[model samples]
Target: MTTSPTTISVPADHVLVWSDEFANDGLPDATKWVHETGRNKEGWYNNEKQYYSGPRLENAQVHNGVLTITARKESNSDQTDWGGQAYSSTRLATLGKKDWTYGFFDIRAKLPCGKGTWPAIWMVGSRGAWPAGGELDIMEWVGSKPERMFSTVHTTAGSGGNGKGADAPIADACNTFHNYQMYWTAQQVIFAVDGKVHFIYKNPGTGVDAWPFDAPQFMILNVAIGGDLGGAVDDAVFPVQMDVEYVRIYQKSK
Candidate 1:
């Protein structure tokens, strides 16, 4: 069963706290991003599977002021020796160098649509580890359902240890560039797409197991190949790319 949407009260007075306009042409600001390497020992957590590793530009690049993450078919020569797979791509994240607690995070981008393509803008806390620290899937979509996007939060207690949080779906998420955003506070987290509110969850009133979002969190962006959620990747659809225009963050005025 799904949980009902919680009430979200946007403060009347707000100001921009942080933002990345991507005004620089060709290449993301290295000062703000650190590429993630190595494969997940258990594979990507969403039951959706993919082996992520590599230094290939075909997997990631910034050109003409846009960041692109492309997934393509290549020989084992292009793949990193993570586990076993010839396909390779890059995953970028701001883990140790930067982190934020409560604020509004927004990403503007156009998605890649094709069978077995998965792209996401998400976050993980900088605390202990994994679901224990907390995870927020701000925007994740499977190409098979290009019309809908999912927003969800995972914590130690609800991450199968207890149960996963509810999911809210948004329509027409791939055809156009839209702002996928999340507003997080000490008590709750609210998710929206293109400025339209979709889902909100209040603090479950337990412990860190139930609410581990009150800590520093970093951002992640990637385009993943078929494994689980993305279904079987169509061999012909390789070289698929995800285009990101900008990422912006705003905090409540102190």
Candidate 2:
């Protein structure tokens, strides 16, 4: 069963606590991001076919006020842990750098448009594991269907195919940049594109299994190539990239 999100304009006051404008022209600020390149032994979840390259400028870089994450049709056979995936990409996360319990997030990005390409901006609880810990997928997109975007909430109560979430259509998703946003509070979590709210999950008033958002969660941004969501890739589009303009976070001040 899918959890339906409500639509309402509930404005909450907040102050900017952190942000990245991509003003630097080099690797993402180490203080803000780390290249998460450790899962080659067991292989990535969702049967993804990409070797996440660490600190590789060719795969992830910043220039002209934009952070570009590129997924190239190349193999990193040199790495001892390389999973032998057919493509190489980057996964950047604010795991150790920053984590939040509740806040307002704004991520402006232009998705890549190549069959098999999967890009996502999501969050996970810092102190828990897997579905029980809680996962908030702010946005997930597959290139094959450029018009559709997804947002889901995963928990021990429901995850994977059972995850409760929703999808919305964007006519120019691949062609233009859009602001993917999320508003998380003690009572509920709401997701939006640009200024339009599409998904909202309210506290079930049950227990942690249904509301793991009480703990700190960190954000992740990456372009995955082929797996469950991203069907078969068209090798013709070997070098697809996702351009991220900026990310901002705000929280209520004590």
Candidate 3:
């Protein structure tokens, strides 16, 4: 069962350090986000089909106080993807422009419904490689399963199919907006949806392999089309989207 927190408000003592309110319409704030382009050698590491496009309006855009990441069933003639599939999407990250060590990260968004859509709001350590650097998946939802959402943490010792993860049932996640949040510190990592805490990964304090999140990490937002976890694609869904209202981060009072 998920443990609900007493309150969802940012603690009175904490101060907002950074935020992207999407005040203006158009491309995302270049000062805060950069798009990860092309298809990875490992099919985006999960046999994903979509060819991640550049910073274009079709895939990534901000409008009317919301950031919309649209995934489309279209071909990318310029790039060669592993799946040989005709689809395109966007993966935006704050790698070098904005990376933080530990803080309270919060995002309010609505997921896309229909098979083949895999939307995620997650983070990764800024140093080392995958597994070694660590990953914190704040929110992950595959369209195949509309009633549940997942959270997971990956480390060198526990990664790939062996990662420590859990899920919570949220029946209307695709139609409603929810606060996907993470509270990280030197001691533990807590994952929550709205105000309810669903999972916690405690630092073993053994070595980097078990807890490689001691360093800085960056945020990532994307909507993948048909992957190992996304199952089959319902091309009829066509241009679906994950609508993000805002992203904010807070730190303890200084």
Candidate 4:
């Protein structure tokens, strides 16, 4: 059982530093986001079947104040960049534009409901390689299991199948919008939704292997197709989407 902050809200000591309201309709703001391509690392690259459509409005777009990241069961012959994948999706990141060391992240979004769809709103360290640099997953929801939402921490000391992680039971994940949030500082990271606390990972103070989050990190939002964690696909549910109403970040005034 967990209890503390039961609702998501901006911290009184922090001020808004960066945000994307998605008021302008079209592709995401070029100044704030980039379509990351290579291998979709949500699951393992080889295990994930969705090819990320770079900067394409069909896979990712904003309209009427909502940013939609869609995943579809379709193929484009010109996708040699992604090994000619049979499914297409989007992965947007604030990689080069902005990275943060610690802050309060508050986001409102609705998830896609299709068995095999893996939608995540997470962050990774900006420096070095995986595990060594650290990772903070605010939300990772796989359609194969619609009733639970995951929050995890990955470090060199604890990663992969042994990573420190937990989940919260939620039923209206696909149909309704919820606050997916994180509170990161020098000592710990708190993961929550709608103010409800689900998990926390501390700095351990052991070494970089156990605490690698002191460096900068960037945010990622994407919907992946079938993979190791995504499980089996349901072709009939083609063209599903996760909608983001807004993303706001606040840092303590120093």
Candidate 5:
């Protein structure tokens, strides 16, 4: 289910703050990304089955000006992961490498359509623990729901699958490139795709429990396998990928 698309217009005075165009064909720029390894103790917080690998070309790579995060069905008997699922993938973040308080973020990508695949471009506060700080899911797509995409925000007041969110139906997301964007300010967080606003969350000014995005936050990108929301897996689409053309950040000109 998706709502009617809304028009989005950027403010005139804005400056690029950071970006990765993935020009060279090879591993991602180390200076800009930090790879996450092992499934967190809580299994990535959603029982996600894929083993998140670090610095592996098979899982994360850049080629022909595009960054690819691939999820492959395989075994990792040496490591412990939820369900011990025989699959591997990549999770990239800018946790300590880079972070921002408020800015406009744009990522152009082509999603993967493998059943049970869950791809996301999101952010988490760099300060405190999960939910206590805050989280912003700029874009998320579940393979089971091929035509729907989501944008959500989580805080102490609301988090997880039940977090505040909105959806948009994009029938060709898997085969076509689309801009997943976000404009964040102290007043509100606006989420859009290809210039269409799909979701918005206004700061209540109540406190951290409701609005904990005042602090710095870092970006994250990953693809997971069958989990709470990812329902069931289909072995047929073993090696799937989410292609990212570029990621850019912008701030209001000073």
Candidate 6:
């Protein structure tokens, strides 16, 4: 039998700020989410090649208290009018609807496995867009190596931020459900999986291009098919699913 991960405890002084236990069956809560469609002009960052279509019921659905984001292949004729190879799916985020600055963001999930799956639980700034506003990768996985996971931060400072931070690996990340979490504070950011810390960045530089994270940021959950990061999708792995059991947030008491 598969046991659920230990329940994360919150200090009595701190209150439950936000969460989606995914207890309801069907689409996600409309109040807190918006679908992301089409491929960005530059394609996905980090060389990720997949087109992140907005939320589509066919690609993202909840059942039995679980949220499933599925990626599938189709003939050219089956593709959407949008550009890119013949694959269709969705991306969901809590952008304008909700945003948070410093808080504990945790997601309990089972990643998809195959040559071309790229699943991520991360956050973006609420400002303009992309690297200009900063990007925090709380957790990211490339299906080619199911045993490893990655955590890194991006900014105008570019990769590694003058060599202060990096992408660290976590073993056994895909075999079972793991809680990927990010602890954000005014002075620093910590990334962890299953409660084990992996990466940390401190004293983030300055300005929106450098440290936009200081302001409110929203959450994103996606399982992308072969793209720049995951490499080209393996035709053999046509259908893949990223299963999320729940998401929870906590903030330190004032």
Which candidate achieves the best lDDT against the true structure? 2
Q: After superposition, how far is residue 117 of candidate 2 from its true place, in Å?
A: 0.6
Which lDDT value does model 2 have at 169?
A: 85
- What digit string (tens of lDDT, one per residue) describes model 3 on residues 69-186? 9999887776654345588889999988988887899999999999999999999989988979999999999999999999999998998789998999999999999999998889
lDDT tens digits by residue: candidate 1, 1-254: 65554433334555676666767755456788777765554455555445565444566677777888877666454333444454556688876667899888879988887888889899998888877998888888888877688787888777633434444565555667888888888988888876677777679788888899888999999887775677777777777778898888877787
RMSD of each: 3.6, 2.8, 2.6, 2.4, 3.2, 5.6
Candidate 6: 10-residue stretch with minimal lDDT = 2-11
Error of 6 at 202 (Å): 0.6
lDDT of 4 by residue, 1-254 (tens): 54545445667899999999999999999999999886633423628888887888999999999999999888865665756677899999999999999999988999999899999999999999997989999999999999999999999998877899999998999999999999998988889988788898878788899999889999999998888899999999988999999999999998
Overall lDDT per candidate, in order of appearance: 0.74, 0.90, 0.88, 0.89, 0.88, 0.73
Candidate 4 — which pairs collide? Answer: 6-195, 7-195, 8-195
* Cα lDDT of model 5 by residue, 28-113, tens digit: 89999998874543466577888887788999999999999999988766665444557888899997899998888999999988
Off by over 4 Å in 1: 1-12, 40-56, 76-82, 160-171
Error of 5 at 149 (Å): 0.2
Clashing pairs in 2: none
- Model 2 ranges off by over 4 Å: 1-12
Model 4, global lDDT: 0.89
Cα shift from native, residue 114, model 3 (Å): 0.6
> What TM-score would you give candidate 5 relative to the actual structure?
0.94
lDDT of 6 by residue, 132-186 (tens): 6677888888888776788778776664434234454655555577888877777
